[model samples]
Target: MTTTTRTAVVTGAARGIGAGVAKRLAADGFAVAVIDLDEAACKPVAEEIEATGGRALAVGVDVADEQGVQAAVDRIAKELGEPTVLVNNAGIIRDNLMFKMTADDWDAVMNVHLRGSFLMTRAVQGYMTKAGWGRIVSLSSTSALGNRGQANYAAAKAGLQGFTKTLAFELGKFGVTANAIAPGFIETEMTAATAERVGMPFEEFKKAAASQIPVARTGRPADIAHAVSFFVSEGAGFVSGQVLYVAGGPKA
Candidate 1:
């Protein structure tokens, strides 16, 4: 890839929203790096992009691990060109009420969501600064506003908003734009798991969630991807430090 060819690194890209984002970026003409905890798991996504005549690389990394994240970024730079777009979407949920949440649960969620974003952003900022153009999108959630049984998740998601705004303030002059996307009730494997965890039938959960959304339907991965695609577009240079709520309705 040439310097003129934009490259993107998307964490947790083996499936769900991350996978959707990776595919969308590739379709938008980016050389995409599909990153996940298991490199092998990223192959299908990467292959799908490649099969569609787009460039892609699969990278295995634990986003929460500083050394691992640094190494992954370095490898991507060497192989795919200096990545100018980053999607810090790797996350995990440890759902429990504050009283019942274990210390391990809180720490695990914090490490993956907050600490992972920090490490990945720190590692990739140099590349972005060098390129003098970059797009950083972090996945937040409506849970950031507060959710039952998600004290740890809520705090971490809220932290990403502050982190994104600060990054935009600091890096705007360098041609880097940082933004957050807070999705509400997206239908994905994660949400399916949530349904099971709460002992509700998946279809019933979707119906219940849909009733609350103004659009009268649950969100899909592609909906969020469309928002991300716009944010990373070259024309979006003027749009930064914004948090887009991709729920079916006004969250506030």
Candidate 2:
């Protein structure tokens, strides 16, 4: 099959790392589905890809909802031509210390990260099995190593690692690869918000984070996107069930 015929679906693609992954995959010659909680939010990403002479579709989906996940995958398969690459990038943070965290906050993060990936991956794996080749990349984080004041967020991210590995084990024989990218200190709106929450200037926060990294630099969405690009590449077929840390240095 021609590269143009392949389809890639990226959730939470309205901005940040998801947008970077979507754009990169589009540039790689796959018809991309730009998905976010609001369909309208996805339009700009899809349009940007189109402006670059690539094909894309905007899909709004709540990845944690089984029906919504199914609908979104079905639509992509029909319109984009059988999605073989899936990126589970939809995530939310309910950052609070365990003492101050509400049950709702914990559940929200769990639903969005862990449950969301489960539903999306389950819905799309069928398409992959049919095609006999697929790539599944889930967004995990350095927080999975346990971040302070992020009990819910960290737990959810950590859970995705097990989810990814199990997928790799079960689906490898079907010619599908499942992996997780655990990024550290990526400069995105999410991190900016975190800085704001802690009453620090964004630049100061980033610099503080950078000082701790061996690379002496913060990360960008494109950095994680580059890693996702490799995980989804045909040459990466032999690589599966792995968690790649995209941090600037080894985890502390």
| Residue-wise C-alpha lDDT for candidate 1, range 1-252, written one tens digit per residue | 344789999999999999999999999999999999999999999999999999999999999998899999999999998888999999999898899999999999999999999999999988899988899999999999999999999999999999999999999999999999999999899999999988999999999999999999999999999999999998999999999999999987
lDDT per prediction? 0.95, 0.93
Off by over 4 Å in 2: 1-4
Residues 6-85 of candidate 2: C-alpha lDDT, one tens digit per residue:
99999999999999999999888889999999999999999999999999999998988889888888888888878899
C-alpha lDDT of candidate 2 relative to the true structure? 0.93
After superposition, the stretches of candidate 1 with alpha carbons farther than 4 Å from their true spots are 1-3
Number of backbone clashes in candidate 2: 0
Model 1 has an lDDT value of 0.95
List the pairs of residues colliding in candidate 2: none
TM-score of each: 0.98, 0.98
